[model samples]
Target: MGMTRLLRQPFSHPALPSVSFASRTIIVTGANVGLGHAAAAHFVRLGATRVIATCRSESKCAATLAGIEEAAGRKGVVQVWELDYSSYASVQAFCARADAELDRLDAVVLNAGVATRIYEVAEEDESSLTVNVVSTTLLAALLLPVLRRSADRFSSENNLTVISSEVHQWAKFPERDEANIFGSMSDPKTKTMAERYPASKLLQVFAIREIAARTHDSTPFVTVNMVSPGLNKTSLTRSTKGLEAAVIKIVNALLAWEPDVGARTLVHGVVAGRASHGVLLDHCELENDALAPWIETDEGRRLQRKVWAELERKLEAIRPGCVAAMEGKEA
Candidate 1:
């Protein structure tokens, strides 16, 4: 992006679908706070018939939903569901319920993410890798049936959007034959703490490419894309402490966009057309070069293939026919 465009990003129109969402259903993960909270409110205000807000716990959603309800007044309908990315079971349960209950699913925004400096591991993987990459990828694939069903039935371009970040540009490409990138990040000897969060986001962009490739021939109508909210004053930095937290607050005050403004980019990702499939939707425009440079060479293709192969195996083990359902377009 040029300096002029970057400077005006916060003011860019979200380019939300001109089409109405009156009868459409939307799902937003991690809706209790951050960009997801703002996005859920946007969808409600835009006339979506139902906005499913997936919170970590039921009690956590009261405030966010109340705010959204107030913003939409009599025009919004919101529902809260539990989704814990640390557990495979929680993801599966949410997907199953969505399939069984929702009549016409339209959009899904995978905005629930974490940026952690700590190397704590959960589900035997680094927390950032588990939540940002693995679990996010798993949920996207599992939810494909519902998204595709909506596209076919409504003849509308329903989207599955994964929230990524500009920080993804900061990661170094993985070397050939590196088995587990997450494990490498957990090792201080091999990892730089500063780059760990970006590395996880890099996986999200790659995963979006891989999925777009997989479903391209089979399910071409449902748009799948990645979006960046730029930097926003959100809970993503709550884990920082003392000097670090103080520095982040200062940076946010000076450089970060408001959560509601950033949320517009998330909405653009949800309604973008098929031309945006497999690409980064930066500043609400389809970007061809926002992906890693390696993706342009044979090495990047090998890397994407290898990483996605492993992800497929891992997610399939937990959800049984989940990955296959993506190809078959079953609901």
Candidate 2:
């Protein structure tokens, strides 16, 4: 993102194409508060027939749902669902319900994520990698069947987006061995708080490319893309403190986008056409999603391929038919 976008971003960006959600259903993950909550509310305000927001705790999400309802001044369409991206089981459970219940899914925003200053491990991987990279990727893969079903029935533009960040620009690939990269990530002593979040976002940039290309078929049924909200004022920095927090607040005041403004970038993705598939949208447009230094070299492509393959293997282990979901009915 450039300085112009930062300074001028508003609560409602008109760049998001006017579209109707009258008979469509959309899902926003991690929507209890902040960006996710704002996105969910935006969907409702835009007239979605149903908007399902995910939160780890149903009790806590009650307020969020109420807030969105209050903002929209409507009732009976917004619902809360449970999801904890740190746990694979939770991802599976959520997908199963979506597959069974949703008749025509219009869009899904994989917006649930964390940016921690400390190293916390979950499911044998660093928390950033576990939640932001692994779990998020897994959920996207698992949702394919339902998305495909939606496309078949609705013939409407279906979107699956990962809310990535401009911080990926800060990523420097860590370690050498592709096999050990995730294992190395498990060791908190090796990466700082600042480094870990960006690194995980970088991993998302890589994984989403693989997911998009492989899922795209002769006929484009779903548009799978990534969106970077630039710097936004959200719960992403809950772990920061003192001088660091103050500096961030000042920076945010000057340049960071407000939550509603940031959420528009995601809303844009839901309406994006096939040209946006398998690409990253920054400031609501497609641009090179990967770091030039890493993506421009032969060695970099090899490393990225290795990492993507590893993620596929892990996803297969969890959901045996995951990769096949991209293939549609054949799978």
Candidate 3:
């Protein structure tokens, strides 16, 4: 039984499909390093007409393009776009650029995220909450219209995948009971450094579920889903130190897959088809039941709705009418 459980956990190289991405456009966030870098190169090698690799710094562009060239053994198909997830303005601006510049958008992998041991804040919330939950979902809401338009123009369902993790299953989420959940999360008194990353991922699961539910009956559909690539050896833990980092280093050596190997699951997710709508994909397989058991309960469902309403208000503040725009409704 122990061996069975261990094997069931996602590890080893995930299979990549033989399908062509020719004439398709893909956007990968944080593509200058780690899994995002590997996935962007995979898209290029797989024949995508345009692969936009977004990073936080402009200085990273040339190096990122060079890395992609070396990995894909190809150049010119990839463009490095500056996108700072720390700023809502940057998120909005990136979407606007995509709207004006791209003829079509086939898929987006929301792979940019952080794992920090510090209690830093950005955009009025905790840094992880801001980047992984708010700005990430805000970007998703704003880009829905673009994805919808692409769906209609190309007569295909475009994918928008949030890179999630199994750690969410372990998140105690002490803030779930608060009337203003996000507000509670923003308070330093409620902060737990060890649990912050997992909680952020849990919030992402909740937000993505709400987005999927709202868009379920809408027209010109885009397939919205969350994916867990499992643990991979990446620089995501570069910020950690001391015993935590030491433990992580040991565990990574024992179980983590390489970024390029883990990246195949990310590529599989973007083209997972309409059936993947509003669900979690684990190891390139559907795993709706794998969501935290609490998420399916009555209280959990209520919290999900509450979070959705609150998040829409937050998104409205960031980009007026974006929530409504996401649902294909007039603001």
lDDT for residue 136 in candidate 3, whole number 0-100: 90
TM-score of each: 0.91, 0.92, 0.96
lDDT values for all models: 0.79, 0.80, 0.87
Please report, as a residue range, the 10-residue window in candidate 2 with the lowest summed lDDT.
Answer: 9-18
Q: Global lDDT for candidate 2?
A: 0.80
Q: Write the per-residue lDDT of candidate 1 for residues 128-211, one digit (tens) a residue.
A: 878888899989988887888877888777889999886687776453356776566656576565667878887777788999
In the range 1-331, model 2's lDDT, one tens digit per residue, is: 4456656654425464356779889999999887888888889888899999999977877887898898767888899999998889999999999988988788899999998887777887888898999999998888866887788776777889889877776776656464578877776666656678878887887898778878778243788898886677887887998998999888888767778777888888887778988777877876644334555478767867878887877888888877777556455
The order by descending lDDT is: 3, 2, 1
On lDDT, the leading prediction is 3
148-255 per-residue lDDT for model 3 (tens digits): 999899997699998988778878887887888888888888777788888898889999999999999889889999888877889998988889899989878877
Between candidates 1 and 3, the one scoring higher on lDDT is 3
User: Which residue pairs show collisions in model 2?
Assistant: none
- Model 2: how far residue 65 lies from native, Å: 1.1
The list of candidate 1 runs beyond 4 A from truth reads: 1-19, 173-177, 186-191, 329-331
